[model samples]
Target: MNTYDPAALECLAAIVEEGGFERAAQRLNVTQSAVSQRLRALEAQVGSVLIVRSRPLRPTHAGQLLLKHTKQMRLLRADLERDLQDLAPRSPGGARDEERISIAINADSIATWALDALTPLARRNLPIEIITDDQDFTQEWLRSGQVLGCVTTLKQPLRGCRVLPLGAMEYVAVASPEFAKSQLPDGLSAHNFRDVTFICFNRKDDMQAEFVARRFGLKRVSLASIFVPSSEGQVRAVAAGWGVTVVPELMAAPLIAKGLLVDLAPGFKLQIQLYWHSWNLESEVLNALAEALTHAAGQSLVA
Candidate 1:
């Protein structure tokens, strides 16, 4: 059997996480030379270039595989520690333990309902690190081992991962009552869309454009739009009559009830089915979190 050094592997992971050699050394409480030497030795043993030497260090493909192993090892170790603690006698002055769970979620879910699902875990003192991305793209974070789990639009699980279905989140095109009256007097047709402005989450967000194309059967219609990256800010901008935008039904419901906004197309809606994807590990904490999230989704999302 070949021997591998855990400390050296840890150094590589630290470098990637910290985004620099100096920061990795500081985190490991070692000298910069020691960190360099260890990485060199590990690279030699592995016979591959593990990292790209850049201003902010990045891991090569080989390095990412090793980093995935490192992260898995850490989770297993934490599970073991928790089991051992359960067997030990309780003491008032015992060290307070907190497990770290890294997950990726879409901005819309986080802004609307996912945070409530995680509240129980937070109350139990579990430290969760959330990486936010578009739901369609969050799977990339899981594939790269940047996060152990993610809330995504992917129904198919990644290799060695399990998936749980979270119901669909509905969205509707909405505008302020005043804007709807003025800008959409002709009532939303292919020809009139050019006159209305839109609010988008970002340039990468194509949901609004997709909705328009699907509804009007007009491909590649470039309507005027302003980008507001924040979810709440997007709603606020639309409410202030900045522009019409697509918003989650849950978010728009309250405002619509109070006459703050009007549904531009009452019959047309977009529903995105979401799923929870996680590594296939027998982790109690992860299982509990998944259950909580699924239950929360059941309550908040459309079946």
Candidate 2:
């Protein structure tokens, strides 16, 4: 096939990301009719359907393929512009304009040490946005342009993005002092609490149950598990002696120190390897933030 029309593909992708031709026009500072015409020309050039004309429009498979390439092109262009600027004479009021950046990260990091890594960026007053969700699904958002960066568990980079290992977040099995006294076995065996109730962050959370199974030599647990969504609530539930729960080292540290909860085992550990994934662009702001996160992770976790 002939080389794809870069300009037309960009316009089409912008339309998809902005949700409509009118919005895309606003972003590109052009007329809506011009955006529509460009899209039609793109479809003709590609010889396939590229979009679904539905509310909050969706990209067809071909559209998605083109959209991914267009975004990479955008990032490359931005980097080229930066390099060109560096070669030019400094403009008046010399600081670069603030660029908006969004990142997707897991909730535990939000509550614990992620903020510390983010502290320098906050001090610089960078226009940064954070989208918090389960680690397993955060990379899916990065695939679209919803976030330009993310902290993900996946070692591999998503399409059009690069990945850098952040570090491992450790988790420990814990329970309230009172609850442990009543529910745990005298010898703490694998089959000790075949019927003990436990607290779980959500269906996506298998931390506590996994610890139990590993400690007991079972593939899975059939015991009663309670679902609690909030990080604070899960820890509080364990503190209240409601049940046992496995919590991140950062989350369980203070409570364990205060004697609100006790470690189920002193040596058991769970570490999730994290990565900082972002568009492979040359924006100074994005690069600075990446450095800040890496520095923070180094200090906080076993990178």
Q: Give the top-scoring candidate (lDDT).
A: 1
Candidate 1 accuracy as lDDT = 0.83
Give the alpha carbon lDDT tens digit for every residue of 174-246 in model 2. 8888777877745245766565777887777766767777777788677678888877888888888887777
- Relative to the true structure, candidate 1 reaches a TM of 0.86
User: In each prediction, how many residue pairs overlap at the backbone (N, C-alpha, C within less than 3 A)?
Assistant: 0, 0
lDDT of 1 by residue, 130-242 (tens): 88877888898889876779999999999999999999999988999999898896566777777888898887788788778888887686878889987888999999999
Q: Candidate 2: minimum summed lDDT over ten consecutive residues — where?
A: 92-101
Model 2 stretches astray by more than 4 angstroms: 1-100, 185-188
The total of clashing pairs for model 1 equals 0
Deviation from native of the Cα of residue 94 in model 2, angstroms: 19
Give the Cα-based TM-score of candidate 2 against the true structure.
0.70
